[model samples]
Target: MSYGLFKKVHYTIPVEKINAVKLTQSLQARITGRYMAEVINVGMGDDGTDQKAFLVLYSSRNSMQNYLQMLLPEFSDILAAPAEKQPRVVWAAWLIPFSGYLVAIAAGLLTVLEFRPDFLKQTVIAAAGMTLLFLLSAVCRFFTAGVSVKEDYLILVRGYMRRSVICVSYDKIQHINTKQNFIAQKTGIQKGNLHLLASALNMTQSVPYFREEELDVIKSRMLKTSHAQ
Candidate 1:
């Protein structure tokens, strides 16, 4: 595959938009070839003129062809744009364990009111302990898992003590999984799962937090690399 295969895709968002600056920075550093940026629309208000710009990105035909090859495990096609995305674990996960804590509190109250049981205190303490454990687990899951793609290797980092990294050359990726549980689903947060051609020591570490559109961008880029190689 050659760079000529790619076709340009243009996207523009106002500077005031959340993550806009980050997106621009990533494009400048990570993307290859000719691009353009200019203020398209500016806000006129008492506050000030907000800088608004249009960004043009060129992706060769080869880039698009390569991207098609980097499919995820269960998905046949790459993701289309999803609106109003968010980072994984932004809030849904933090609140999941609290639901259990709420249940425990309700149970404790019921036990104390209906029966003057000494065990009620023990049960409440036990519930608290379990909730603490759940919270810790969520923290670990949030911090330890992520994906990083370099020129040739796509890296996944997972776990604390059971730490490991899996390096898959861009061409070998068989599939990618972007998933969310009921908690994450409701809140519009997602975690990514990358499945490759061959088994590695740790396959699970590739999961990463991503906003929906961000995930699509990554998948597209990885696929482009895979095919280009």
Candidate 2:
């Protein structure tokens, strides 16, 4: 096929009053054979509402033309305004893992000071090595983790040593849950879990520390999308 014959069409859908499941099904039915829809979670509203946005990428010109023809009548209500792309991880994510590392290093140094002052230099070196390892691992994970939303599907990318990208369709999602500890809550960071119907496995994704409002937006969107299909 000629490059000119294929054009990419992008749509950012806003999740609000519309039935997300129905909308996704309708779109999926139409584009199944003609084009692939790449969906991405563009992030949530700063206005502090449960507003969620999605970016859909269509690679086929015919499918794009067909979708555009029906978009206004079928999806305009769910169409969302453009949103700023959220960063992959926030600064607090960089700090949380190091908190434990800090505690461990402090305890080690104190033990050496009380019992073996002559080994202080060795303790410091060991502590520094441990700190460097923890920092490296945390930074790698922070950079590697990612989540993407698509029509009828959600994609989770995670890990550093054994990286994996999992694609789960909305239909296969049995439940969506969120968790936060007292410190996590205070820091505005939370973890989300997706329960899958097929293997009875839970896929977990962590949101780096962010505004509580933004977290709510992301959680709401996931729940809505999972339930919709």
Candidate 3:
């Protein structure tokens, strides 16, 4: 069973009340990037019994406004942005194979320079192993992956070996993260996972090998899709 865990809750500053332009300008100056936020959802809680507004953000100025409108339908009828506008890359799955290929070629070269017949065998074996690994990784990449934009649900499937499928919905999504390790960066592969509200059923649906950038795109799409009404 898979579940989501709550990591953090970020409160928003009012757009009208704050100096939106000045704040944005400052952020741009300091970070050399544009900033945007979108209001996603709103409702009252036990503390204030007041409606809350949720928003999404983008570093790009134009994209931010568009995402906001998508999240808040009552505010606008325009489509702000696709759930996934920028995709993070996952390089490892792509890298491992290529790395394997390179190593095999290197081994062959070493064999030639050293005049050792065994180098050819070693290179062939290494190349074969790497090629197989790459093939398997790429194949596994698409196996059981699933995403639900309407229900704000996402499912990740890892087949066979330690295989697990995880399912998560927005209300229960605890965390969404993007990570790239040193090796993963070489191939541009980023991995992501979801922490969900804990429960026996959900624990069974937890995902293990999620592609990070793609997952965020799914999340963005779901949140925006939910507001279509």
How do the residues 17-108 of candidate 1 rate in per-residue lDDT, one tens digit apiece?
21110012123322353222222122322134332333322344244324323412111111121212225556675575577778877877
**Lowest-scoring 10 consecutive residues by lDDT in candidate 2?**
17-26
At residue 150, candidate 1 shows an lDDT of 47
lDDT by residue for model 2 (59-120), tens: 35455445534642433222231212224444455465567769878988999999999999
Off by over 4 Å in 2: 1-89, 181-189, 200-229
Candidate with maximal lDDT: 2
User: Which candidate has the highest TM-score of all?
Assistant: 2
Error of 1 at 185 (Å): 6.3
Give the TM-scores of the predictions, in the order they appear: 0.47, 0.50, 0.36
* Model 3 per-residue lDDT tens digits across residues 54-172: 24333454564565455433333122212221122433454665676778777766766588665677666866786688667655444423332333444443442223223334544
Residue 206 displacement (Å), model 2:
6.4
Better structure of 2 and 3 per lDDT: 2
Question: CA lDDT of 196 in candidate 2?
Answer: 44
Name model 1 segments beyond 4 Å from true.
1-89, 97-116, 181-189, 200-206
